[model samples]
Target: MDLDLKCKTPILSYSDDEFKQILEIRGKTLEQLPEDVNIIKEWLKMQPHLPMHPTDRQIVCFLIMNKFSIERTKEKIDANYTIKGLMPELFSKSPLHPDVQKTISLVSCGFMPKLNKKLNRVYVCRLESTDVVLLDGYNYFCSFLEMKTICDFSDSDEYIFDFSYFPMKMVTKFNPMDFKRVLTLVEKVYSNRIAGLHYVNIPSYAEAMINLIISFLKPKIRERVRIHKSLETLGEFFEKDQIPKEFGGTGISLSEICDNMNVLSKEYDEYIKESNNARVDESLRPTKLINDDFLGYHGNFKKLQVD
Candidate 1:
């Protein structure tokens, strides 16, 4: 099947300076990492079962993630494909069933239509229901991951996680194992893509929850996670006019943005299904055992250190 890897979402309009900066990064990456394309081609040659033909943008994403270090890029590329292959339930394509749709509707997560002043795409996530477990939060979370394929354009994307309505009970429902999966995907696969993660309207107990999540993250990523006391504090990173009205900004509502995303999700369903073929086939791989431990944690969640 011919996979359409084209970004379906409207590309963020960058300022002259931002555009120039992007070009400089891309040019430098190409110069420093000239063998990047050939590296992927050679890797693909080994994985006969994997049906992916990565685009220039996709290859560049890994390059930028590793700061143009060819060795690190190759390592990341290998880990990324391996994880996708191993965890088909999480990474593979499945129909966006009604249950998934219901979860998505409850958990409003999507990229804001507009870019911040720094030309970074802002991603907004809010949980409307405190019964996160019943909401099938894992699959709901996966929907945002799927959306990122099309929405993630800039080298650095800003994240706004609204926890105003999130209660302590709901926080407990979040499985540490699932949290580990998210961190692994972001750190290992989607590295350097996140500019900053702003947690606004944080509940008093949210700090503990935040700490638990950050413990799974790398130091660099942990540093980027900022807790905002109010929307005013968040405004330091994003303009008030650009923010959605739900978050005390003058822009559109979160529901409206999510509505748009829902439409896009339906349209891109085919692409998501086709992309599953891109996962590496470990059976055919020469390297039989890569470090499959995504977060390096084992045993029951209760035993895991949350503090």
Candidate 2:
């Protein structure tokens, strides 16, 4: 490892047990990973559009995300950096724009630690604010995931969006275009494997809003969504302590959970700062990469995605 790569603080943190567990999840172990890293590093040197010398830890995570398929891993690395110029909204870094902070206050959100036995990390979001029609949904969702990504690296990501506190009067205030953009970022760029998406406390009045959001998702992702009339069904998927107390689970209140998340916010400030400087230089790319399956529908991806 280069001295600089070794000296830098690791961006992704997990316990020793998790380190072993994640490898086991994919039929891999620590023994052979170094060889894999070296192989990819040689490949990286030939690609001028990306950083040739990221740390071993960074390569391992990207390998895990792509299940160590060499070709897929290369594509994901390209898409990951290609993302910034393609959709900068999702990269909105911290000391967040004032509008992002405002959007956050309106929604109580957190990526909860207590995952199901399925190893699915749940991103819990609730529209906790009132009749205010939000104009900053894009910034809010983008900002939320940016901070959450550093700590939450489960094999599969799940979501529970509580629509109870929301009012029907502001339905039209939502731009499904934000939903479209968010879907694009998560599927085509982040490459986070989504296990499922759950919508709870959705009254009949709020059904259309959920439907509209679902419409923008690709079929594969849309098929993973489930709508619940109330919170009653959550117990089947999560333990009592994993679900929030307000919903009759023993877990702490949503506000408290989100407040605890602030501790991670500062931990991430420097990471996001460093990442913001790592954009892809298309002129250095070896070949033109027009939009394709892995690139999603981003019209700008002609300069992105490897294959």
Residues 155-176 of candidate 2: C-alpha lDDT, one tens digit per residue: 7788888777877766757767
Backbone clash pairs in model 1 (N, Cα, C under 3 Å; residues 3+ apart or in different chains), count: 0
Q: Between which residue pairs do clashes occur in model 2? A: none
Candidate 2 residue-wise lDDT at 272: 60
For candidate 1, give the lDDT of residue 229: 81
- Candidate lDDT (C-alpha), each: 0.63, 0.66
For residue 149, give model 1's deviation from the true position in Å: 4.0
RMSD list, candidates in order: 4.9, 4.4
Task: Please provide TM-scores, in order, for all candidate models, with all chains considered together.
Answer: 0.78, 0.83
| Candidate 2 deviant stretches above 4 angstroms | 1-15, 51-54, 93-95, 130-137, 143-149, 294-307
Expressed as tens digits, the lDDT of each residue in 1-307 for candidate 1 is 2323234455233444553455476566224443665676676677664456556556655666566667677666665555555445565433366666666767777777756766677878888976444335554455455445443445567789888788788767867776776556666665647778888887877678778777777687788889888777777778885688988888778888877776776776666666644655545656444333442232222233322
RMSD of 1: 4.9
Clashes of each: 0, 0
